[model samples]
Target: SQQGEEDPQALSIQEGENATMNCSYKTSINNLQWYRQNSGRGLVHLILIRSNEREKHSGRLRVTLDTSKKSSSLLITASRAADTASYFCATDLLQGAQKLVFGQGTRLTINP
Candidate 1:
């Protein structure tokens, strides 16, 4: 399975702090995407970095990928209370249908 697993099931941070999480996958992938879900709301795409890429950043979010190790990390810097959400890593399999398989996810809470 190309599915990925994210570490730190939950995280809490004070406003203006940083939050980091990790994800590990089992197989090769075309690309990996990070998404954020606010409670019951649908996920919102944060960023996507291809397998060939080492790192990418957007706004306050930064993502790093290591294909050799089949793992990735996400960092949210200077987080705000509005940044509190569940984060997930999704990998697009190279061989199968182009669909994203999500990780277990890391729930983040930013206290104001």
Candidate 2:
């Protein structure tokens, strides 16, 4: 499948701790994007990295991509209760017509 699959389907961590999630894809991609969705809400774009980039960071969020292995990881540092949400990874295939394939997503919970 061209869609990416996220690992550790669910994660729970204390406030101020860090949370990490992983995604693996089956086909070549032009770019990868990470998104967050609060309960009963639309998705919020977190970050995007191209196939040429190995790592990227935005605020407390860090993302790393390894094209060789068709894998990517997202790390949220010093997490807060507000960070509780479902995270999804979407990949834009290299040969597709600007389509994105999203994974099942990872459910993250932050405890105070």
Candidate 3:
């Protein structure tokens, strides 16, 4: 599968803590995007980093990409219970245009 692999698969943390997830892809990519999905809901775009970028941030979210390692990570600081959801990393391959391959996802549970 072109889909990447996310580490930990699942994580549980208390509110106000930080949560981190890692994703490793098999091929070179044009860009990487992080998404969040609550139960029974559609995916919400969190952040995106281009191949040329090493890191990007959005509010409480921070994303870092390492093209040489074909990997990326997502960090959510001061997580809240509302942050409980599934996070997925999607990659836009350099060769495959107009297509995104998504990881299996990392399930995050933030307890109050």
Candidate 4:
């Protein structure tokens, strides 16, 4: 499994602040996706940006892709305490079964 690894295993920030997380993968991918998990609940897809795309944004979330570096970064602007959660990056390999391999994730905490 060509899974990615996220840095800064944990992070804490004040409400309304911005949070950034990085992800690095071991293999080429067809696309990359970001997901948010609230506590022990199921993960919810946050964004999906293809290999051909450089960057993407949704609401306060921004994602950047760099195939050359085999890495990606997710940024959350104006984060709220409600946004406190674990963030993971999954890579969809172009070949093989096209399954998603997830990273260890960054545990984010927003202090109110």
Candidate 5:
């Protein structure tokens, strides 16, 4: 299983500041994906970086992958109060086929 673990179980930041988090995975994977969850709601995919790729960006979100270390980092620039949510990193494992394994997640709070 290509499961990942996230660091800094929790974080607190004010609006306009950037929030960064890291994710580490075990075993080789096909791709890595980042997601955001608002409270108890469902998760929304923020970005995806393939194993062959090093980095990717979407709006204020930036993601970097280091396959040599089996880890990845996510940075949210100029965060807002609405960005307060739980962020998760998932890895796509291809064992003959494909499946996604999610990490524990990082809980972030953006204070006004």
Candidate 6:
């Protein structure tokens, strides 16, 4: 798979705690995207970082990319119970093939 791996396969946190996860890839990429998915539902686009960008932020979400290390991280600040979801990182590595591959994902749970 073009996507490498994500650490701490599972996470359990309190509603007010922060959650962070890391993603690594094996191949070069034009862009990397982070997504959130609730149980039995579709994925929600959280943020996107291009090859040139090193960091991005949206609301309480923060994303960082380190091309030199071929790695990325996602941080969700001031987490809420509603923020509990499975987070994934995706990238299209086929060049002209136009296919996006996803990592296995980090399951995050926020307790009240």
Best by lDDT: 2
Each candidate: what lDDT?
A: 0.93, 0.96, 0.94, 0.93, 0.92, 0.89
Residue 17 deviation, candidate 3, in Å?
A: 0.8
Ten residues in sequence with the least summed lDDT for candidate 2: 1-10
Model 3: how far residue 40 lies from native, Å: 0.4
Please give, for residues 1-112, the per-residue lDDT of candidate 3 as tens digits: 6468998799999999999999999988999999999999999999999999999999999999999999999999999999999999999989887989999999999999
Assess every candidate by TM-score: 0.95, 0.97, 0.97, 0.95, 0.94, 0.94
For candidate 1, the per-residue lDDT at 88 reads 96
Local distance difference test, candidate 1: 0.93
lDDT by residue (8-28, candidate 1, tens digit) is 999998999889999999889
Q: Give lDDT tens digits, candidate 6, residues 1-109.
A: 5475776689999888889999999888899999899999999988999999999999999999999999999999999999988999998674636877899999999
How good is model 4 by TM-score?
0.95
Q: Which ten residues in a row have the lowest lDDT in candidate 4?
A: 1-10
Q: Would you give me the overall lDDT of model 4?
A: 0.93
lDDT of 2 at 68: 98
Q: How accurate locally is residue 26 in candidate 1, as Cα lDDT from 0 to 100? A: 89
Better of 2 and 6 by TM-score: 2
Over 26-101, each residue of candidate 2 has an lDDT whose tens digit, in order, gives 9899999999999999999999999999999999999999999999999999999999999999999998786799
Better of 3 and 5 by lDDT: 3
Decoy 1 TM-score against native? 0.95
Backbone clashes, each candidate: 0, 0, 0, 0, 0, 0
lDDT of 5 by residue, 48-84 (tens): 9999999999999999999999999999999999999
Candidate 3's clash total is 0
